[model samples]
Structures are given as structure tokens and as C-alpha cells.
Target: MDATWILRLDAVGDGPRIAVKDCMDVAGTPSTVGCRVIAADALPATLDAPVVETARRQGARIVGKANLVELCRHADGINPWTGTPVNPLDSARVPGGSSSGSAVAVAEDEADIGYGTDTGGSVRVPAACCGLVGLKTTAGRISTQGVFEFSRTLDTVGPLARDVAGAALGMAMLEPGFTIAEPPTGTPPPLARLRLPDVDPALDAAIDDALRTAGLQTTDVRLPQWRSWITAAKDLASAEGYWAHRHLLDRSEHLEDRHAGGIRQGRDFTAAQVLACRRSGRAASAHLNALLDRFSALALPTLAFEPPRIGEVRRGSMTYLTAPFNLAGLPALALPVPRGAGALPASLQLVGAAYTEESLLALGAHVEAALAANRR
Candidate 1:
């Protein structure tokens, strides 16, 4: 099980054990975004990323550097350099990326919690694939000072854990000065379930049954022009990603075809196109925010389908439903649910208004507990 650790640290703390993505700076170590090409010439980080430093201060043990898609450019956990981390749930399937290793570490109990950066559904997709709780916080809510920049507009640090509480605890530790209000106690709050075309029937049914068991009322909502918004967000991410790594695309001799292809896609957009995309994205955020005003949270499938075989992922066709939230800068959580007997795990996503992570997590905790009770 080559879980893709650039460096493994000695267990040195009594607090929550953590596996941080290789993209995050770790003081003395060279922060490699799991790319051997760049890692060969990478310089050691003089200081820890704000998130990693805070974790250490709070007594969280830093276990190792987790693996990820090269430059975090791919959603499918396939890398040409370091081998992809095997999905602990099923060896035949892709583990999901670009936060693949972090999710794997937490899923396999190698770490109590793991940290991953979400540029475009990186953290959430892997959590869904691995049956873990993943939290992608509101952009800029936590500092990104020591992490590699992928898409400046969409990148955010997040946590992956076995349950909501572990993830919540990790988030609290990472943001030392920020205060998370107490979650609403007792039964889960009413949720707004997003009704989108193209969602898998099995995933929809799983979420519906889970919500019903949790005693949470679901309101069906179809955001107008949703598909256009998704496209706009995709364009914006590509533009920003291209800008972040254009030099590598232009001159690096060690570029992988998949990684280079993504960068080139970003390069194809004109400045005007990117601005138009951002404008469209902002409009979408407002539209979603207005709809969210009437409900405690927006629920939907984390991904449209179950994890595909390692080589079977159809990059453009496999929908990553979580990306829109990143574009909207909303706090989103992925909660695992049973798919069926002898099936891969499916996940339900709960999205809340920006900075409402506490409430959203509280509701998730309630639902998780309720589902466990129902199973018994």
C-alpha cells in the first residue's frame, strides 16, 4: 500500500492524528504537490502553512505527506510518477482525487483525520469514494498561505475524517482564532434537496432514504440555469489554473500528458472569456444563496455515480457535483451513506451558506447518528 507519503514523521503528539496533503507546507520539508518532476527541484518550506502550524500547536500529530494527482490537476486519482493510492474500499476502482491519499489515510485508519485542499471537488469526491466525511470550507475562511496554488479563485483547505465530529474537530484546530458557534442541538433541521437532471437513481434513492430516516424534511428545488452555471465555473477554474502553472506548461520538460492537457485547456481561454465566466459565477452564487435562504441546508449527491474502475473514469462525463459549491465559495460537507448490499459507498452532500459550517456540520452529525440508529 504505497499511500504516497513524501515524508513520514515520527508520531509525536497525543491529539488528533493527521495526514496532510503534500501540497501543504511542512516547515523543514519540501512541499511537493505529489509530483516527482517538480519535487526534484522543490525548495524546503521555511515555515509551515497556517493550517499545518495550527494543527501542531493544538497537539495534533502530523503523520505524513499524503499523495495527490499531479499538481492537483486531475479529478481521477491517476498519476504517472508516484503510483496512485489504492482505494481501500475497492482495489479495482480509482480512489478519487486530487486529495486521494489524504482520504485514503483517514479511511484506512492510518490517520484519525486528514487535510486536503479543494480546488475543484478534490477533497469531497475522494471522501465520497472512500466513505469518509469531508468538509470544504468557505474560500479564504482559512488561510492558504503555505499551500500550492492551483486555482486561486477556487482553492480552499479542508478536512476528511471517519465522521462529522472528527472533521469538525480538525477544522476547529486548523482555524485557531475563528470561533465556530455551537451546533443546534437535537433533531436534524429541515433540508433542501436539490433536484438535478443526470443524477444516478440509486444515489438519489440512497439520499432520500437517509434523510427520511434522519427525520429531516426535504424540499425539492431546481435552480434555474444550473447547467450554465456549472459550465461558467469550470471555465473560471481552468483559466485560473492555467495562470498558476502556465510556466510549467510552456517550458517544463517533465510535464505529464494529463496534467499538461489541463493546463493547456486553461491556456485556451482569453482574458475576456475568464472575466465573463467569473461574472456568470458570481450571478450563480447569488442565485444559489437566495434559494438557500429558505432552508437550513441544500442536499444532493456528492458525485453523480459510484467510483468507477481506475482506468474507467470518463473525466468530462463523470459529474463532480461538488465543484459548483467551490465556485460559489459555500461551505459543503460530504456525508457517506450505505448504497446497498455489496456495493461501493455513495455520499450525500449538504451545502450551507458561506461561513455557516457549524450549523451544517451540526445537522450532518444529527443525520449520521440517526442513520446509525436506523441500521441497528
Candidate 2:
């Protein structure tokens, strides 16, 4: 029997098709984590990662393994081991990473949904760039047992789909003891809009137009200082990621400069620095929690700027806007909005309180349905 058929046969449900990110173990396949070094000698997984197993058990067809950034290190989705996947919307531009292929698969209609681990903005970035919906559920909401780690505390299994309903359906299968809530009939709670000091005017206008089209009310608010929190998140992510793959880095015959660079940054951080970063995370979480208490969700642009060109190092505040939620361990949903003049999709992000993924999905579904009706 063909190996692809064998894998697809394991799927139990007559449900949506899904492509698991390469970093995730799929039982009969080697978990490459998007690096030739790992794939060259790695053994096939003896068991599926919990997320993948659950997805198959829930009837989602395991179409194939999607490519990712090398070692899941870069946000740009360039993987030398497996060629970069082009954004379906704009072939000249990069499909966001480290979940690049997963997003591309969905965007190109190869799969109904794509499952990937989100550490930082992996899933959201690609989803937005591909004009899809992606959710980074609260930390610990989905099991990560067989998935390769980036940051144990920040890593999460999330899904990207063409619409909010597809994402919600995918989440139900991947997350144990979780299901999408029924559509809310009453008015949605007020949304607290987050206006970054340097937000792009075009993106801001798109967000406002989306809210107005959906008849959603928004009140402006600000959370704790984002730069400090993001800095800490980066430091800790580097440290954790370094330790998780230290053996590979030490043993591999040849390590790519990009992968080696990230690993090396984490090598020098003392335990004391990790602790300080944790403390910073706690403070940021507390402030965000307080704001959530007063608002249904915090709204912001998923990406403050356009997707960077292939091979360009994206530098600036726009790159770190989603880092705060990952550091805070909150639930964030990235929903595709209207396209910009360049034809690439604009995305609006909704950050919810911890463990509030169901509510967030409910709200997202509502907005998705409203927007699809051409309410304007």
C-alpha cells in the first residue's frame, strides 16, 4: 500500500482535511522539524503526537506533513531543507512562517485546515499572509507531548483555515475536552481596541472598517509596556529553544547559520536571566488580565505592516506585536480582513483572557459570519 494511503487511512472521521506541520510526529514519519540534519538520521516516530492522534481520531484526514522554517526558528518561513512554500495570494511574497507550508496548503486548497505549533507568531503570520484564519490557543490548552519544543511555556498547537468555522472545527479535534461554543445570540461584549503608537494607518483603517461593517463597538485601551515584555519573551524563547535542541546542535555535522545563530543566543543566558524573564511575563499577564476583565477582547492588527519579501530580514516593532500574548499565555485569534492596495490580506487580531478560547471562537465565528454576509 502507498505510504500516503496508509497515513490517510488512520484518519477516522469524514471531516476536514489537515496537514500537520513537519515539527509534529506522525507515527510512521520522521519528525524533521524542517531540518536536513534532523531528518537525515531521525527514526520514524513510534507514536503520533497527541495533537495529530487526536486530529485523526476526530476524523481529520492527515493529508501530508507541511514544511516549516529551519528548526522553526525564523518567522519568515524560509526552509533550506524543504524549499519555501509560496503564498497563494501573492507568489512573489513569502508565505509566513515557521508554519509556512501549512498556511500555503490551506491557501491553495490542498487542505481544509493546517495544524502547526505556534511559538511566537508562526501560525498567525502565515495565516494572515495567506488570507486565512488562525488561532493560537492559550498555552497548555492543547497537548504538546510529541511536538518539538520551541519554548515549553510559549509553545502551542494551533490551526489555520480558510474561515473561522474551519479553525473552530480543527480546534475541537486537536484540543482534548474542548469544543466550539454555540453561536452567541445576544449582543457581544464591548471590545477594547489596542492602538499601538506606531500602528500603520492603512491597517488601522482596515480594522475600523471591519468593526464598523460588523456593527461591533470598540473602546480604546492600552496594556502594559509591550517592548519590555517582548524582549523578555525573546530572551526566554531563545534560552528554552536552545536547551530543547542543544543535543542536535552539538551533534549535527553541519548546522545552518540561521539555526546556529538562534541556538547560540540562548547559550549564554544564565538561570537568573530566565527567572527575570518569567517575572516580566507574570507582570504583563496580570495587566492583560485586568484589561480583559473590563473588555470582551483586545483587538489589534495581526501584522502592523505588509509581509516582508522573501529573504528580507523583517526588522521593526511590527514584527513583535503578537509576542506579548505568547509571553502572557493568552488565547489569540488572527482573522483575515480586507486586502491592502498590494492585494495581500490584512488581518485583525483578537486576544482573549486565559483559557477563553471557546468564547474567542464564538466571537470570531460571529464576526466571520457577519462579514461574509457583506453587511456593509
**Per-prediction TM-score:** 0.95, 0.93
Residues 1-376 of candidate 2 have per-residue lDDT tens digits of 1111112324545678888888888888887777877877889999999888887777778888888887888777776556778777777777888898888888888788899878889888888778899999898888989998889988988999999888888887887567777766777778999988667788888888888777889998865587788899899899998898888777555677768878878999999999999888888889999989988899889987877777564643334778888889998999998654556668989999999989898888877877778734
In candidate 2, which residue ranges exceed 4 Å CA deviation?
1-13, 183-186, 251-253, 315-318, 340-342
lDDT of 1 at 63: 92
lDDT of 1 by residue, 1-376 (tens): 5855657888765889899999999888887787766787899889999999998988889999988888988777777687888889898998888899899889889899999988778888899989999999998898898889988888999999999888888888887654445756764446889998888898899999998898889888887677777787788888898888887854456878877787888888998998888788688678778877888899999989888897789885443587778778899999999766798878989999888888888888978999889878
CA lDDT, every model vs. true structure: 0.85, 0.81
Worst 10 residues of 1 by lDDT: 179-188
Clashing pairs in 2: 13-59
TM-score of 1: 0.95
Angstrom error of the Cα, residue 171, model 2: value is 0.9
User: Residue 42 of candidate 1: its Cα lDDT?
Assistant: 93
- Quick one: best lDDT, which candidate? 1
Clash counts per candidate, in order, are 0, 1
Residue-level lDDT for 323 in candidate 2: 81
